[model samples]
Structures are given as structure tokens and as C-alpha cells.
Target chain A: MSDELYFKPLTELAALLDTKKISSVELTRSVIARTKAVDARVRAFNSYDEADALAQADESDRRRAAGKARGPLDGIPVGFKDVIAVAGQPLTASSKMLANFVSPYDATVTQKLKHAGAVVWGRLNLDEFAMGSSTENSAFRATCNPWDLARVPGGSSGGSAASLAAGEAIATLGSDTGGSIRQPAALCGVVGLKPTYGLVSRYGLIAFASSLDQIGPFTRTVEDAAVMLGGIAGHDPLDSTSYETKIPDYRGELKKRKGPWRLGIPKEYFGEGLDPEVGAAVENAIAFYRERGCEIKEVSLPHTDYGVGVYYIIATAECSSNLARYDGIRYGHRSKEARDIIDLYFKSRAEGFGAEVKRRIILGTYVLSSGYYDAFYLRAQKVRTLIRQDFLNAYREVDAILTPTSPTPAFKQGEKSDPLAMYLCDVYTIGVNLAGLPGISVPCGFSSGGLPIGLQLIGQPFQEAELLAIAHAYEQGHDWGERHPKL
Target chain B: MSAPADLNIDHVANLARIALTPEEKAKFARQLGEVLHHIEQLRKVDVTGVEPTAHAFPVYNVWGEDVARPGLAVEAALQNAPAQRDNMIVVPKVVE
Candidate 1:
């Protein structure tokens, strides 16, 4: 095993493939072999088809050799979170409900990746139906943190982050509803971006909390994430929610931009529960930026304290509506002994969904149900507005806000068994999604436990380019990216 | 404030649809109470006259020209159904 290639950044991999120094087929073969080496212990993937991956890699090599290179990600291997569909591939979303479900067509994002000449390495694990903060709730299996096998890789994008951190793939795509993508990236010591809500098409992604979900990339560096956003961000006719907004050259912004950025720090974020080491890491990161001629100021997101309450209400409501299609009638799972059509609906749903998923669905159904709509769902929707306004007002005063990505660094696996305890892992992140803004989690420093800590940077809507540039500059300024967990 | 334990769990479970065993029902009631207590904190803030916002920004309402495009073929849509028999999706009969 070449240690040099194991955690190499995506750009380096692309260069190696382009110059004929290393062929895409060779890299694909190496990754498959690496996955085989670590899979039993890591449990990051639910499925992998080696022949198809190699075939795509061969296609990439042919295009590069002919000087008809597809795009920046021309020969890299990338994993798709199971919720996204790839034509002719099964997209189980790690649930029994969709266990045998094969997508008849490619998701708009999958089509874009293929057009850019990337190989679909495999489908990574996720929470059943993309619920839950820890992948422990996954019906398939929990994804272990690469840093310490006993600790969880934060989820619902847990497998996507673990794969990138463990060198199973160079980059992987993940969808964020609440903190799915960023939380896992923070826990895994990798970079992940959640593009502004409408920036990417959601045409074929298995629906979760629709209003909040956005697809983004988890990669080793800010620049690789930018390259991926370039490919996957675009409007699609099939998804009405996709933004008609222009796609900027996110990588180019890294060069053309300079910052004396006003960075906002919310006092609410540094409340009692934050770990001492995690607090120090964030302060040190802020100090580093201040030394680089940035302004650090205290800003109040007064509504910040209410983020979780509003998030659960809104997220669950959207999920309940989106999940209505899975009644055992149209697709996937069917109850073997249903006595009638209605019994089939009830039994299939009862048996198909896992505990956490059912909890959210029921909560969602309750809130949206006729009697409680005015008091619970309606009030949460109003609070959601106030939350968005708070960010909008804060952005007016600051170029971007800086905060600890998680309250504490990654915890021991199964440490947070109570579901509410698990949900708190997303407190710092969910507000950004609520605001429909772009946010990135970058490796900042290490906790006392020797696990990595991440600092989140959030910018105004459509400001991904500016946000990525600052993240890139910070990565260049620090030594955090050099440290990797020993596999 | 504690009511009959059975009543509280029954109300939530009947609404939620899990066939919780008696012990599981009791456990869930306790956990659910704790979670609801945390959420109850939001009620302390004054939100008078605040309009509820569903989307972050003001998006233009998109109404399309009234034109029909290709719809999915019936066979294509039903091809993945686990219990489809005939043109309709087949399932077990339900008793009223």
C-alpha cells in the first residue's frame, strides 16, 4: 500500500491520471483493493460493483488520452450517498423499505458526474431514509469513525465521510438535511460543504426533509469540494426547487479574493456544554484569522437558542409529506401476509421503516395533522422565519460567521444512545440550513482526546465561492490537513 | 402534572402507530416527556406579529404555460412495484 496515494487530495489524483503517471483504471483497482482490505472493520459501504467502476475508469482514460478531457474530476473515484440514484443501480437508502429498489434512471447529479467522467465507486451507507445523527440507527450497520473504530463517524452522511477519511474514495457526495453532510465531515477530519439549498438539483435524490435537503461534497481539501460543486450545481427541469441562479467559478474565487473579512462569533454558540479543548481550538482558529487582518466581533443570533426546536418541527413535517409515497403499493417492500390493501399499507410501512424513522414520521404526522397544525406546525413555521431573519441581519454586519461545528469533538460510539442527545450534535449546523445559506466545515485543530475539531464558516446565500476561498486560505495557513488518522 | 401513565403513552402511541409493548410504551413516554420539555423552552420568547416564513428568500412563483409534456408510461412506473398484478398495484384485502 502506497501511503502517498492513500489520502492524496483530489487534484493530485486528477494530475496523476492526466499525465499518464497513473491510470484511472489502476487507481480504481487500488481503491477497490483498499476497500476490501478495510471494509469488514469500517463497514462504510453497503454495496460495491468493481467491474462497473473499472469500466468507467477505462472510459475516463480513453477520453483523457484523446485530449477530450471531460472536466476537472475526469478520472477521480467518488461515492454517492445511498439516497441518490444511479441508473441501473439499487438505491436502498439503507432501509428494508427500498432494499430491492433499483432506479430506472440516473439522478440529475449522477448524470452530471458521469458527464464529468468520474467513476461511481459504490453506494455509501446512510441513516435509514436519511434520519438520525449517528449512523448507528442505520438498518444495515453503523459506520465506524476512521480515527477510532469504537467512535461513530457523524451521520446521516456517515459512510460518505468515513470513506473519504479512510481512503476508500477521494471524494463522496452527501445530502444535508439538518447536519448530515457537515457533521460527519467535522467528525471525520475532512472538509464538507452544504451549498445553498437550491444550488444543486435534487431531481432523483430519495426524499427526506425536502425543503431543507441539499447535495454537496465531502473531500480532503476545499479546492476539491469546489471542483465537485462546479459539476453538480445546476438547475434541472425535473426538480422545480432547483435554483435558476448562476454557477460561479468557485475555484477561481480562491485566487481572485482577498479578505479583511468581518467574522461573527455568537455568544450563544459558546454556552456551558462546549468541551474545553473544543473551545480552545475555535478560539485559536479565530485568533489565526484575526492575525491575518480579519475583524472578529461578537454578534448575537438571539434566535440561535431556538434552532433545534424549529428544526425538528420543520424537518419532520417535510419528511412526513415526502415519505407518503412508500405505502407498499408503488415500489420496494411489500408485507408478505397482508389481509387487504389497507392492511398492506399499514403492515408494509410498519415493518419497512426503522425506529428513528418511524419516530420522525409520527411526530411529523402529528404536527401536520388537522388539530395540532395551528399550534405546533404553524408556530414552528413562523419561528423558522425569525431564524432566517436573524442570519440575514447578522450577515449584513459580518462577512461570514465563525463557530465550532459541533459542541464537542467526536464522542465514543454509543455514548449518546438517547435520541435527543444524538440530535444535539447538529445544533450548530441546522441553523445554516434553515437560513438557506452556504456553510463549510474545515479541520481546525485537535481535541484533548486527539480527535479533530472543525470550525464552521457560513456565508450569505449564493456566496459559496467566497466561503470556499476563506476555507482554502485557512487550510493553507494551518497544519491541520497534514494530520490523518492511521488506518 | 403527572397524569395516569397509561393514558399519556396511549395518547401518543395511538397517534404514532407503533405497537409498543407495555414496557416500551412506558419508556417512550418518559423519553418523549424529556424531549418535549426541552422544546417547551421556546415558548418563553415573545414572537408577537412575526410572520411565518417557509422559504429563506422570496422566490418568484413559478407557474408554467399550460402545456402537457411526456408523462411516465404506466408500465414503466409500475415495473418496480413489489405486488403489482394486472394494471393496478395488488395488495391484501382490508376489512371495514
Candidate 2:
């Protein structure tokens, strides 16, 4: 019975809790026991507190019993990727640099989640500082894909994806810099939404590439993600980059969405490195949409090839400046054997950061350095403008853009030991980040060898409501979202 | 711009404030070169007269009401500091 409770979708679980069929405490305990049991192989969370989770669950139960429940998520268990700040909880970003550091206050997302009465769980592991495409860059441990324990769960939000798929949490939140959220969601066979950059506040999310970093959700279905996205997204005076826009009822929009949606499949996405099996699966999705009377148009996003190049330059340059804050002054680790200030700064950073982080910092520092800044950083940004224009131009012809979320399904743990090959893993999804638009990865089908593949649908900025509706329409047409990785 | 082969890992490491060993330096020089080569594809496109896009979403100067509010307490602020003395973070001395 406890094992059976692990895999129910959030909507079903909520209905059960709402009707008093099962108390929140009972559900929370089941999730906790399952997390402990499967965590030995999965390693999804870096740290979680059973006492705190159970206490919150009991409080939720008491509120429900008294007819004072706050909202749809009142008793729901939600996991957070480690980088998000939760006051008094550790905020490591899975890096040794902040291995012992605790946040002084809540990030905007955490505050919103708590406000919605979610039983906020614990720190899910991520790529150190949310840099890598795979969570192996985490200093602690890599989160294993639930579909196959030998493979990665995709990253930098690998743990978030794994936990939801493994039923450790009903839903989870993750930050996408490049394809961090969507790519992982695809590999883990779950729903992941990357909202438009400013639509969600970034006040408490640890900066990866400030310009590209946006926090989003990972869930079992499109509707839960829609519900949660509404919960967390809003205007905040704290995050300067956050958009000042009226929040939309995304779940409601999903309910009222009608027929005749337009979806464009970019020719550039289906070429070269794409695995044939993943291609065939997405083709089926296109046919399904066509059968539902939606127009399937072939569109051109001209600058798609240059997206990875432009993104690496811009993301790294911003991160170099953002990460310079952890220089052993106010908080975080300081070198033990420093002779003076110079030695302290150098040694502390050198000792603290992992190899991947240092590599990015070095690349970023070089690009932003005096002589080369215009040639590398400036050129990249100009190219970014072109990439954004490509999406903007394409949107003139289509309501949504559809493509494979990843070139292929999740590969074995160390298959991509070479960094360059791993970076290419995000080929199909990075352009959306450059344009700062909303995109989602919903489980469309699975690859041979039984790994899941994702279908990415991108929408105009601030049109997450419409985007979620499109995803929900396709999701309800098939049984893909209902399938879970058997642990 | 210089060729991708001349990315200069040591100089970059110095600028980044990290000290890389000879092995790491050699590995980065090779790896970063490959990444730079991948990025070099952008040179084919003409960005002449095009303004650089620093952010996907445009932002005007953001403002907040000029009112003071409660912030993180001194205790909480200093709680995560690796070395704190009397509510102040301690660092290596810079001035003589």
C-alpha cells in the first residue's frame, strides 16, 4: 500500500486528500518511507528532514480537518532543487564552495510555495552551481535515472526530475539556464515547464547566468505544472529582472482551451545528431495534433545553428560576474592556508570550485577580459539578438513551435565524458532560452531500450497559459504522461 | 579575435582567480579550444548595425517605493559567514 502510494499523479492524490480518503500525514509518511527506501540507488536528494516534513504534513491535515485549508497545494509534497534559498536551510547548489552555507531568508519561489501551503520538503541535488547538462558535476552524488539506474536523469535539475518520476515528491521545482529543466524532464519522462524569463521572480534563486536562469516546475502532468506555475509566478519588487505582468489562471485556461491550434516543427531540429527512434515518436505526436484539427506547419528558425555558440558566451560571461560574489569575504568557504588577501581570494576560489565550474569561470573571464570582450562577448550578444529574432519571426506564422526536447533519450552515466559532446545534448532546447520565451517538455513517447522522449512546445513571452493548454491538449490525447518509470 | 587554439588557459585562470595545475591547464586549453571552435560558427553571420541583446526581455529602469522595511536580522545575516567577529565578517587584511 505504501509503495502503491508513491506513483499516483498529483491530481488524484489531491482529490484523495480533499475527500478525506487519506490524511496528509499518512501521505507524507508514505512518501518519506519510500524516499528512504529507494534513495540508496536513486540519490535524488542531498538532504531532507523527516521531522520537519511530517510536522508540516500534520499541520496541513489539521487545517483541512478544520475546513481552513489554504489552497490546491495545501498538503502536497514539493521538492526543491538545492540552489533555491529556504531560510535556515542549506543552499549549496551542490558545490563544496557552499557545502556548509545556510540561507538567511527564503527565495521568492520558496516564499510563494509556503504561501500556497505546500509541505516544502528538502534539498534536491543538482549540477554544481547548476552549470552542467548532467548532474554528475554535483560534488555530492549523481541522481540516477529512475527508468534505468545505470543512466543519468538529465540535469542540472536531474534530482528534481528523478524525484517526481520516482514518486519521492508529488512535484518539484528546478531552474533552467540552458536546457536544464526541460532536458531532464524529457529524460525522466515527466512534465517540465520553463516560464518566460521575467514571468517568474528570481529573487532567491542562486544566480547561474542571471540573464538565462529562470525557475520552473517538474511534475507528473501538464495540469499540475499549470497549477503550480500560477502559484509561484508573480511580480515581486525584490527581483529586478522579474516582469511586472498580471498573473493568468493557467489551469483554468487549460480547461477552456479550444481547437485549431497551430504548431511549427523547425527543420533544423530534426537534422544530424537526432536519434531515429526519438524522431519517429515526435512524428506520431505531430500526426495526433493534425488529427485534432491543428495545423502542422514546417517553419524555419534560421539562426538555430548559432544558438549554442551565442548561449555559451552570454551565459558564461554573466555567470563570471555573478559568481564573483562568493570570494570568501561575507560568507562561504575561505582557504585555510592563505598568507594574505590575494592568496586568500585565489586559493579559496581555486580550492572551492569543481572542475566544470572553474572551466566556465575561466572561459567567462577570458571572454569578458579587455581585448577579447568585443570579439567574443559582444559578438555573442549580437548573435543572441539574431536568435531571438528568429523565434519572433517564426512566431508570426505559428501559435507554438514543436520539436524533440532532446536529440535523444537519456544515455548511460558516463557516455558523455567529453564536455563538448555533453553540451551538444541541449542542441534542440537552448534557443528558447536565448529568446527568453516559455517552453515545456511533455512526455510524448519512449525510445527503444525503453527510455522516454520529450516533445517541446514553445510559446510567445507571457503566454505560458496558452502554452500549458497546448501541452495539456496533446497530453490528454495520449497515455504518455500517465506512464511512470518503474523503480 | 585570435585563433581558437590560442585561447590561453593560464591567462584565463589568472583572470578568474583560480590556480590551475599544469595538467588542468593543458586539458582546458584543449577542451576550451573545441568549445571555442564550436562558437566560431557565429563569425559567418553578419551582425553589422545590429544591436546586441543583453537580455531576452527588455527592462526599463525598475523602481520601488522609497520606504524602509524590515530586512534579514544581523544574526541571520551573519549565520552563514565562515568567519565572523562581532557581527562582522572577517577577511584577510588588505591595508598596511
Candidate 3:
């Protein structure tokens, strides 16, 4: 019973803990054991402290014994992407620059989870600075897709997705800048949600693209995703961009907002580079909605083609600005050989950053540079306005937009060595970030070759309740998420 | 407008404060040229009166109270610094 406890959903585990059927220690130990057993192969965690996790579990057990159980997340083991700061823990972001850096303070989400009695588990791996689609850009190790070990786990939040799917954690938190959470969740056969921008605080998250980055959850089921989202969704004064809107009871709203929603199928999502197997899976999902009395319509987002182009410019520009804090004089790696102050900055950055980080920084710097600012950076920003309008126009007719989470299922490691080819992996998902809408990827079906495919539901801004209900509606009829990877 | 192929890698890398090797400069020049060529499609979009969106949800004039709050302790603040002395981050000489 303890061996399989890690695979249980948060709701089920919460019930057990409430009934005193299982101790939080028992549940946490099971998850820690599972991680130790399989993380050698999955390469999901950057670092974990078993003693610290057990200590937190003990504290949670004490709370429950005192009839002070905080909530559903109480005593639950939840992993965090290394990009989110967990005080006193190594927050590497899977980058060598901060390989030895420990977070000084907890991220707002981390504080909230702890307040809810969650056992803060481990620091999960990700693409260095959350820059790449595939976890291959991680300076550490590439996280393998659990379904097929040779294949890549779609990433920047690759470890967050893979860990949940592999039963290493009951649920995990991941930051999605573009498709980091949803794409990896799709690949790893888990439920991943990117909340509406500014819904979750970004105070302690290692900045990538400030305008686009959002922290969300990865869980085995849509219901679990809701529970996790509720645990972390609220405004923080620490993050100025965090909106001061009332965070609804997302899990409760799932049952209340039973929607025969008007779902829009964006035609651009099904074209050209989409893999047929992935396409069939999404089409089947659309058909599922149609049969269930939900109105499905064909919608055109004309600026969809320009999403990738606009995103590359905007995300990179923001990143180049955000990442400038990593000078050698402060925390993180410093160059051993430097003659002057300027030389130190150049040598430190060159030596500390990975290839992809360097490439993006250069591109970002170039686009935001003196002569090209109007043509590249400013032009991309204007186009961003158009891309956002495309979504708002569609929402006037439909409650949510349905699309594939990723154009293709998880590709083999090193399959896409070209940076351009790699950037295209995010084409289907970038538009949501550009528009600041809530999006979720629920496992729709599996490919013939056994890769999992995800169906994405893009909801109106701050309407995660409706989106999760719609996702939960489809997820109820399917067993795609229940069937775990045979690791 | 300058062509995408006209990206000067040396100039950009210098601005970014990243020292690139001769090999990296050449490789990046060719690769970024391709990416820039792809991004050139944005030029075709008519943006006569469009407003640039810096953030998806623009929250303006977010003023917090002027009360002082406790921040990281001195010891905690310098925990990750590569070089430090008396809680101050050590840096190379700036004065000539």
C-alpha cells in the first residue's frame, strides 16, 4: 500500500489523511522512495532533500493530529521547478551559473503551499533559464519522456511534468513562459495548467520573460490540477503585476460550472507541421465535445502564423533584460580571469551561460539594440497586440478555444538540433501567453507508437474554472490520464 | 530597413557583454540570420495605429505604502555571492 501511495491523487490522499488511514510521513516516504528508485532514469529532479521532506511531513502529521489540517494540500508532496525559489534549497534553474546558488527566500507560491501544510519536496530540473521547448537545453541532463525513454520530454518544465507522470510527486509546480507547462504535460501524459497571466505571483521566480512567464501546476488529473491551482492562485503585493482579483474556489467551481461550453477549434492549429497522430487525437477530442452537446465552431486567428516570430522577439528581449542581473560581482558564477570590470562581465557571462542562453541573449540584445529597436522589438510588440486581439475576437463567439498542446508528440532526443526547428515546437501554445489567457492540457489520447497526446483548452482571461470544468468533462470519459507510463 | 543578413554578431555580443569565440560568432551569425529571415514576415502585417502591449494585463500606478519592510538578513543576502567581505559583495577595482 505504501509502495503505490505516491500514485494516488491529492484528493484521495487528502481523504486518507483526514480519515487517519495514512500518515503524511507514510505518503511522503513513498514518494521519496519512488523518486530515488526511478529519477536515475527519468532525470527529473535537480536536487531533493529527503530528510527535509520527512521533517515537513512530520509537522503536517502533527497539525492533523491537533485537528488543524489546513486543506487538501496538507501533507501532500509537491515538487517545484528549480526556477521558483524555495528558501535554503538549491535553485539551479538547471544552469551552471547558479549551480551552487541557494534561494534566500521562499517564492510567494512556496509560502502559500507551506501555509496549506504541503510538504515542499524537491527542486525539479528544467531548460537553463526556461528558454527551450525540449529539456535538451538543460545544462545538466535531458529529462527523458517516460513513455519512451529515448524520446525527449517537451520542456522547460520537463522535469515538473515528468516527475508527476513518473509518480515521484503527488503534484508539482511549473512555470510556463510559452508552452513550458502544457507542452511537457502533453508529452508526459499529465494534466498541466498555465493560469491567466498575473493570477499567480512572480516575486521569487527566476525571471525569464517577465511579460509572459506564469507559474502553474502539473498533476495526474484535471481535478488535481484544480486543487493545485487553488493552493497557489492569489495576488501578492510582492509581485506588482499580480492582479488583485478574487481567486474563486477553483475545485468547487469545477462541479458548479458544468458547462455545455461553446468550444472553438482554431483551424490554423491543425495545419502543416502537425503530426498526423497528434492531429487525430485532438480531432477525436473535438468530436468528444461535439457529441457531448457542446457547440464547436471553426475559428480563424489570422495572426497565428506570426505567433512564433513575435514570441521569439518579445520573449528574448524580456529575457535579455531580466537575465542581466546575473553579473559575476553578485551571486552566481564569476570568472576567475578578468583584467577589468567590463572584461569580468563579458568573461563571466560567456563562461557561465550555456549555448542556447547565449544565442537568445544575443538575439534579444540585437533586437532591442539602438538601430533595430523600432523594426524588431517595437514591431514585435505591435504585432503582439494583434495576436492578442485575435483571441479576444474568437472569445466573443466561443467560451474556450480547443487546440493541440504541441504540434507533435515528444520527439527523440537530439532530433531537432536546429534552433529554428526547435522554436517551432511552441507555435501552437505561444498564442495563449501572448494573450494572457488560462490554458490547460489534458491527455486526450495516445499515439499508435504509444506517445501521449494532449488536448489544450484556451479559456478567457481569469476563467480557469470554466476551462478546468470543460477539460474535466472530456477527461471524465477518457482513461488516457489514468494509464501511466510503464516505467 | 536593414536586411536580416546584415546582423553584426560582434556588435550585438559586445552589447550583451558576452565574449563569443570566433567559431560561435560565425555559427550564431548564420543561425540568427535564418531566424531573422523567418521573423521578417511581421513586417508584412499592417500596424498603422496599433498600440504595443508590454504586458498582457497592464496594471498601472501600482503604489504600495511607503512603509519600510524587513528584507533578507545581511548573512542571508550574501549567502550566494561569489566573493564577499563584511556582508558586502566584493568586486574588482573600478577606480583607475
Candidate 4:
């Protein structure tokens, strides 16, 4: 009974909660208790208020009992990445810079979740300022992969995935900037989706790279991810970047598996650094699709090699500008020893920012510097257009592109100390973001070490529903979605 | 790769307004040089006449009704301030 309740998909839990078969408080407690038991090793949550969670859960129960349950997420518990604001709650973004800072307002997504009747809980760990590939860069603590305690859970969204892998949360919200959501979701063996850029509001998500950053969901199934996306997606007047498009029923197409859909296999993704086991598993998935009357074709995204270089230059350039707000005056840490304004700016930032963040900031400042702007940042932006055009060109030939989410399965924590090595982990997933295309990472198989490997599907802009359907077709054909980590 | 002599790490740090210790300066200089070396690969692509995409989706003049709306209270806004005086965020004196 405990196992059944703890790992139940968000959709299943929603149904159970609606029917009163299990109360929200019970479900919330079970997840909280499970987190306490396993998070010592998984290190998923940075902070969780049990009393606050219970109160929300208890309130949800009363509302449901009165037949006044809110929306689909009513009575469900969802965790938030530390970057997303929750009113009066810690919004650390996993850095010492904002270690003691609390949000003054609820983020649009948070407000949406509350309106949906979901009990918001937990400040999930992330790379400090959402800047690194591994949660190892978090100033607070590194989150561990539930599949293998020694391996990283992938990152930026590492804690979101780790929490789900260990059954700590029913579902989670993670932000993707240069594959922060999809890469971690792939590494940790859960279903995660990054909607087409601007589909979800970014009003209160602490900016890392404004252009590339987008908020999405992590769940155990494509259906749950679709449901989570539906609850949070739509135009928000507060976020000027939020897409002004009709929000469709994201789960409507999950049930439509009518065949003969075209899937593009990018030759670039299967190249060097791909582990043989992971390649074979995605290959198997492709074959499974082919036998079901689907057409699989080889497509070229020729500018793929430039994705990483272009992404770093562009992402960091924007990051340096966005992060300038943390000047230690209005909010966050201040240097106690500074004798003047200039001294304070230098000391507080040096003391507060992490090494990875500092490295990116310096690089960003250099790229945008007077002599180098045309040579680096401008050049990268031009290349970024080519990279984006490559996707636009590919989608004309096929309905979607399929690739291995990461080059390999999860690696050991601290295995990659080279910053470039860490950046390369997002190679397969970054270009999709550059093009503003929607993409998802769902478990395809496991490696010899029992770590999960993910297969990604990229869809055309504003077609997340169709994207979810294709993922659902593959997910329902296999038991990958059902396999939970043996915590 | 050896560090580039053209760019001084301290100058860049000054541009970023973050003062690093001597040890941090040396370490950042070396590491930033390595990453810049990696990023130099972008120069190989011929992007002549390619329009730079600052955003994937272009939405313009996203105006809203300009009216006074209730915002965070003074106390709430100042909740995270490092120092506050007279219910205002206190900072170093900008003028004599």
C-alpha cells in the first residue's frame, strides 16, 4: 500500500485524491516521510516545511470534501526548483549570493499551482543561479542520483529529478536554460519537457539567461508532464516574453497514437561520446516505432557542432546582464568590510558568487566587451541563427527529431571537473532551446550501472501537444515509465 | 593551452565589478583562457548576412494598462535587504 501510494503517477494520485480513496494529507505525509528516509542519500530537497505542507494538504482535503476541488492539480503536492519564487519563502537559486533572500511575491507558476489546488512544497536543489550542468555546483549541497548513489542526477534540474526518482515528490517544476531541464530529466530517469520558449511565464524565475531560460515539468509519465504543463502554461501579462498563443489541452493527444508519424533521427546525436548501451537502447526504441508503421528518416542538423560554443557565448552574455541585479544593496548578502560603494560591490559579489557563476560572468563580460563584442557575442548570435535554422530546416522534412538525451548515462559525482566536459553534457539538448522548439526526455533504458538513459523528441514550435503524443506512443509501448528507482 | 597575454584577468574582473583574491584571479585567468579557447571554435562558421536571433519568438510592444496597481508592501519589499533604516533600504552614501 505504501509503495503503491508513494510512487503513483501524478495523474493516478489526482484520481485517487478526487475519489477520496486517499486523502491529500496522507499522500503528502507519505511523500514527506519517504523523503526523510531517502533524501539523506539522494539529497534532493534543500528545504521543506512539514507544517506548511500539512496545512496546505489539510486545506485541500476540506476543499475536496466540499466538492470544491480546484483544477486537475487539486490535492496534489508539487516541488519547486529554488529559482522559482514562492511568496515569503526562500528563493536561494542554490547560491550564497541569495542564501538568506526570500521572495516578496509568488511567481506566476506558483500562483497557478495554488489556484489548481496543489500543495506547494520543498525548495529543490539546483546549480547555483541555474548556471552549471551538475547540481555539484550548488552552494548548498550536491544532489545524488537515486539509481546509483555515486552518480550525479544531472543538473540544474537535478534535485527535481532526484526527488521524483526517490519518490519524494509527486511531480516537480524545473527551468530549462541550455538543457537544464531536459538533460537532468534524462540523466535521472524521469519524464521532463521543455515547452517551446515563452509558453510558460518567467515572471519570477530568477533569470540566468533570459533568452534561453524556460520553465517546464518533470514527472514519471508523459501524461503527468502534459497535465503539469497545462496547469502552468498560458500568457501572463506580467511576463512580456510569455507566448501569446492559444493554450491547448496538452493531454488531449496523449491518447491519440494513430500511426505513420514521421520521426527524424539526427545523425549528429549518435556520434562520439555516446555510450554503446545508450545508443542501442534509443536504436531499439526507433525500431519499435518503425515496426508500428511509423517512418524514421535520417536528418541533418549540420550546424550541431557549433551548438555548445554558441550556447555558452550567448547564454553567458545574457546571464552577466541579468545577474547584475544582485549588487548586495537592495537585497541579498552585503560585504561587512567594504569602506566604499565600489569596495562593497566587489567584495560582496566575490564572496557571494560561486566559482562556476564567476567564470561564466567574466566570460560574458569579456564577450560583450568593447573589442570582443563583434568577435565573440555578435558572432555567436549569428551562428545561433544558423543553429536555429538547422532545426527549422529539419522539421520541414519530418514531424519531429529523436536523439539520445545525453551522450551517456549519469556519470559519477565529481567525475567531470573540466568545465567544458560538463558543458558538453547538454550537447544533444541545447539546440532545441536555441530554436525555441519544444522537447522532452523520457526514459528509454538503463545502463550496466543501472542508471537510466533517456531518449529525447523535439517538436516544432507551439506543438507541445503533438510532441506529448509522440512521446506517449513510445512510453506506452514500453515499461520504462513504470520502472522506479529501488530506493 | 597557455593563457592569452592580450587580455588581463584583473581588468575583466574590474569590468564585472567583482574583486577576486590573488589566488582566484590566477585560477580564473587560467580557466577562462581554456574556455575562451574552446569558444574560439565559433569563428570557423561563416555567418555572413545571417540575422542574429536575440529571441526565438518576436513579440513587440507588449503594453498593458498603465495604472497604479498594488505592489509588495514596503516591509515585504525590504524583507531581504542586507540593511535597512527608516523602513528604507540603506546603502553607502552616494554624495557628501
Each prediction's RMSD over C-alphas, in Å, is: 2.3, 1.6, 1.5, 1.2
Please rank every candidate by DockQ, starting with the best: 3, 4, 2, 1
Location of the lowest summed lDDT over 10 successive residues in candidate 2 chain A: A1-10
Fnat of every candidate, listed in order:
0.46, 0.87, 0.89, 0.80
| Per-residue lDDT over A1-487 for candidate 2, one digit per residue giving the tens place of the 0 to 100 score | 1336667777778889899998888889888988988988899999998898899999999999999988778888899999999887888999989999988899999999888888889799999999988799999998999999999999999999999888899899999999999999999999999999998999989999998999999998899998899889999989888888989788889888875798898999999999999999999999999999999999998899998888889888999999998788778888998999888888889888998998889889988998999989999999999889989998998999999999989999989987789999988889989999999999999877999999999999999988998999998888877777766
Clashing pairs for model 2 are: none
Error of 2 at A337 (Å): 1.2
Clashing pairs in 3: none
Q: Identify the superior model by lDDT, candidate 2 or candidate 3.
A: 3
**DockQ, candidate 3, vs. native dimer:** 0.87
Look at candidate 4 and give me any clashing residue pairs. Answer: none
Q: CAPRI verdict on model 1?
A: acceptable
lDDT tens readout by residue for model 2, B1-96? 233755777777788888788888888778888888898888999999999998888788999889999988999888888888988988878998
lDDT of 4 by residue, A109-223 (tens): 9999999999998999999998887899999999999988888899888999899988999999999998888888888889999999999999999999999999999998999
Would you list the rank order by lDDT, best first?
3, 4, 2, 1
Once fitted onto the true fold, the runs of candidate 4 whose alpha carbons sit more than 4 angstroms away are none
lDDT by residue (tens digit), candidate 3, A56-146: 9999999999999998999999999999999999999899899999999999999999999999999988999998988988999999888
Q: At residue A319, what lDDT does model 2 achieve?
A: 90
Each model's C-alpha lDDT? 0.84, 0.90, 0.92, 0.90
